[model samples]
Target: MIAKAYLWYGVYIILNVLTIAGSDPSGGAGIQADLKTFSALGVYGATAITALTAQNTQGVTALYPVADYIVAAQLDAVFRDLRIDAVKIGMLANVENVLAVSSVIERYKPAHVVLDTVICSSNGYLLLEPCALAALRDRLLPLASIITPNLHEASVLLGEPVAADEVQMIYQGDALRALGAQAVLIKGGHLLGNCSPDWLIEKSGHTRISSVRLKVIGTHGTGCTLSAAIAALRPQNRDWTNAVNNAKIYINQALLQSTRLSVGLGTGPLHHFHAWW
Candidate 1:
């Protein structure tokens, strides 16, 4: 097994994270957003592109998936070189991609795997193929250390309506855990409220993380940013709760400052570099 904590010259080295996901030429979501989040959080980032998407803040025009074997090769090459501290997985376009990712996760067994269960885009674009949902639920969900699914994705996974309140949110979180995930974080950003809440359920316990609902136009990539923040912080924190707490704070700030950017015609993106710029 890889060392739980890395100490080089009596100082903890920078955490290395891999984003085994798709490419968004828009630079606001998917692999681009993941890499930006890693860099902003002082984590070294590596990537294994699963697909390439033609998308922008407004909408997605087209999507082209990479071959499953090629995706596997990229992951193998990274594992052979870097001590990948955490992995943030997004958009697995098809069943082949899902199975391929699950295979590598089983082989290398990264210490932390934050699965961003991105089923569709905010603009109503389908990111993961409908046929792949079963493969993801059966093959990939079980392998994740924590699965971060927004309310809609959670509903889709559970075949139920979206949670309307905290009680229902917790209920959904519990139900997701029953599906074999080690932990579940159900994001309630789409809920109608002045305060956005996220329910994080783990073996140790669960916590309700709430923040002021920052109304900003640059709301794209919030999912990628949040999950990436958790992945980037997990290696440095004492436990998952501590990591998630700090990640919420980071995302709150990102949302608070999102209006500083005006990149796209539609929703734009959260300010991933808010800490720096």
Candidate 2:
């Protein structure tokens, strides 16, 4: 038994990271942020672009959804070539894209699956169409190890805007669990308050996390970065608490550093590479 345990441990260490998220032409969010997080944590990152957006820190202007078959092909190519350790899904813009990625997840059953429900742009632009959301709820939610939804997405998923309050957030988690997600990480940024409180609710129990409200006005790809950090760290046997805590620390530092540099003309992206300096 000891020898077998040691072997398993060795396997885990060797396969530390893999992910599938959308591409951000702006390079502030989506796959760019995910890959940066993975690299920062010393993990290899992989991705399958779901859609392409023509926008930057300011807002998304135009989006072109990748064809369903192309999305499937990207996953197949990655699976055939690499030993994927974990997956982080974001920004499925259409029903076909959702179905395509969900089908792949069902087949491979990666060790860790983090879903950053990118339902809309940070500026309140609709990223996922209504039909796509329907597909996500019906096909994808049940498969995720954890679904990270901000207040707006959580409210939309439950058919109502969950009041942005502590008591209401807990209820929102329960409502999401009832919908089939094994775990719901309701991000508290949208809550109208001085401090943002993020909550993680699971079958066994719940936990609350908070950070002093950030002063930075531009936060473009923060969600994607958070989800990717969680996925990258999860394969190392870190619990969700540890995963989220570390992710928050990384994001906070990036945001603080990013506030100093002017990136885009509109809303700027988190300074993902700031750690180097």
> What's each prediction's TM-score?
0.95, 0.92
Writing each residue's lDDT as its tens digit, candidate 1 over 1-277 gives 0113468889868779999888988898888988888888888899999999999888888989999999999999999999898999999899999999999999999999999999988888898999999999989999999999999999999899988988898999999999999999999888887988888998777788888888678888889888888898888887778888888888878888988998978888888888789
Query: Which structure among the candidates has the greatest lDDT?
Result: 1
lDDT (tens digit, per residue) of candidate 2 on 222-270: 8988888888767665487877877788888888888777778887888
Q: What TM-score number comes out for model 2?
A: 0.92
Best TM-score among the predictions, by candidate number: 1
Q: Residue 221 CA error for candidate 1 (Å)?
A: 0.6
lDDT score of residue 107 within candidate 1 = 98
lDDT of 2: 0.81
